[model samples]
Target: MALRPAPVGTGIVFTRIDQGNALLPAAYDLVSETRLGTTLRNGDGVGLAAVEHLMAALWGCEIDNLFVDIDGPEVPAMDGSAAPFVFLMECAGVVEQGASRQAVRVCRSVEVIDGDKRIALTPADDFSVDLLIDFDNPMIARQSSCFHGGSFAFKTEISRARTFGFENEVAALHAAGFALGGSLENAVVVGEDRVLNEGGLRYDNEFVRHKTLDCVGDLYLAGAPLLAHVDAHCSGHGLNNAVLRALFASDRNWKLEPVMSALPSWSETAVAAEA
Candidate 1:
């Protein structure tokens, strides 16, 4: 797959070369499914699955327009993190377009809840995330992350975090043809008493950090980058998409704003890539 430059207002589009070159938009309204990951389907039913990691990387890098040429059904689950996708964007290098980037400035707080899980977005002068997770397993008891910086912080503190699953769940996932490409090499598998990975962890609480990374990708489905503080607990892809729908339904909930200076690191990195 390759990322090609697109004109302003193009948003993110995925073209399937094998599927008669069908195009699908990476927008919330185009989201046809959100099982374990986000799937975008066009009216003709041409689909792309598990795009969150790539989308998250694009959001972190402040990339607003692009054409993704893919020969397969889904983006490769490279190492189960956004870091690889970040690397792809950096190598391609980003250039400023004639128009300023747009962001959805939250005006009213929006919340979505499903039993014990919940997610909310509140108006803020800057973007941030507050995430919390708790599991029944002793190995991954409770973890929380609060991130307050932009691109650089995401790469250093959140990007390297890999997706994780339980040993008991892996067989079931593969049986269902869900994680056929998943392995200990791409995901951190946890046993009852310890992690199965040889390297232990990239961070002490990598599980929650990966969840925060997913949240970043999920929220970008709003069709533009967000300029609000987010708070989430025990929420996954389902609840994330629900919250975005609710936020977009209410007109007073958000407004568009010109890009600010918070994303200088991505711009600077792009320059370094071309040197």
Candidate 2:
């Protein structure tokens, strides 16, 4: 996939180069599937999957507009984290747009509940995420984390956490036509009593940290950076999209407002993209 600078208001659009240049806007309403990963489809039924990592990187980089040119069905699951994407963006450099950035400020709390899983967005002065997860596996019984969003914080704290899966479920996922390219290099594989990766994990609570990364990416589907706090428990791609839908269901729930603060120092520099 190639990332190209876009004029203001272009938002983040995906061009399906293999499918007649179909345009898929990364918006919550267009989210068609959320089984294992989030998928967005255009009117012509062209869909793209696993976009959460790259989207999270874009949010971490404070990028407002870009065109993603991809010739595949999903974004490259590079090491199953947003770190690679963040590195590429830094190498390419980010440019501050002429206009102020807009944000979806949550005016009231909105939530989605499915059994014990729950996700919510509520008013906040700045973007942040508080998440919790639970599993019966001894390796990951329960983990919780809070992230105060910013470029440096995201890169150092959340971006390198790799997506994880269970060793026993690999065959079933494969049979279901998912994780076709997933492996130890791009995902953390949990065995009966231990992690199957060579070096163990990047963070002690890496699993929950990775979930926060996915949350940032999934929430970016609001078409802007959020000026709110996200609270999620036992949530996944499905509930993430559902919460966004619920947040926009009422005009009183949120307001689109311009961000008045100055751009962060990291984005102040302008650099040339390599050939």
Candidate 3:
């Protein structure tokens, strides 16, 4: 993957080089489904999988314009989290153009609920997140956390947090032909009594941290950076995508901001590039 500069107002677009560099807009209208993970499909049959981690990294870093090129069906699950993506962006470098940044400022509260899961977006001065997770397994009982704007706290604390699954689910996953690339190195696995992966648990509360990480990524589908306080509980890609769809379904829910009076301050290295 490469983080190439994009024209202002282009938002974030993913290009599949294997398919003639076809472009897929990263928007709610293009979201096809959230089976094992979020998938975006374009009219031209171009699609990409597991985009939430990368999206979260970009949003957390306050990158308003970018072009991502990939040559596979799935973004490389590099180290099973967003840390590698962050490192790659750091290496490729970020550039600021003459144009300012635009964001989708939430004007009202929007929410979606399914059984015990819920996701809500509320008006806020800047992007923020509060998340909680509860699982029956002892290894991951309950965990929670919150993040304020431009914290990028998620990068060091949660970005490398791997996706997890149960041992019992593996048989069914393989039967369904999923998790073909999953392993202890790429994911955290839990048994009924303990974590199956060696050297278990990067953080005792890693479960919730990963969930918070996913929210940051999924909410980026709003088509721009957002100024909303999001709260979620035990929500996955499906619920996150549903909340975005609901937000887009009604004009009363949200509106686009075309002008940006300020751009986020780039790092010293990135600032030099802009100069």
Best by lDDT: 2
Q: Comparing candidate 2 with candidate 3, which one achieves the higher TM-score?
A: 2
**Candidate 3 local lDDT, 52-167, one digit each (tens):** 88887776666767778889897777766777777777666666656556667788899999999999999986778889888888788888888764735766786878778888
Better of 1 and 3 by lDDT: 1
Per-residue CA lDDT of model 1 for 233-258, tens digit only, reads: 99898888998999999899989877
Model 2 lowest lDDT segment of ten: 266-275
Those runs of model 1 whose alpha carbons end farther than 4 Å from true positions after fitting are 174-182, 260-275
- State the lDDT of candidate 2 residue by residue for 57-170, as single tens digits: 988888778889899999998899999999998989777766777888999999999999999898998989999999999899899999985879999999999999998898
RMSD of each: 2.7, 2.1, 3.1
Query: Model 1 scores what on Cα lDDT?
Result: 0.85
In terms of lDDT, model 2 sits at 0.88
Best by TM-score: 2
TM-score against native, each model: 0.92, 0.94, 0.89
Cα error of candidate 1 at position 196, Å: 0.8
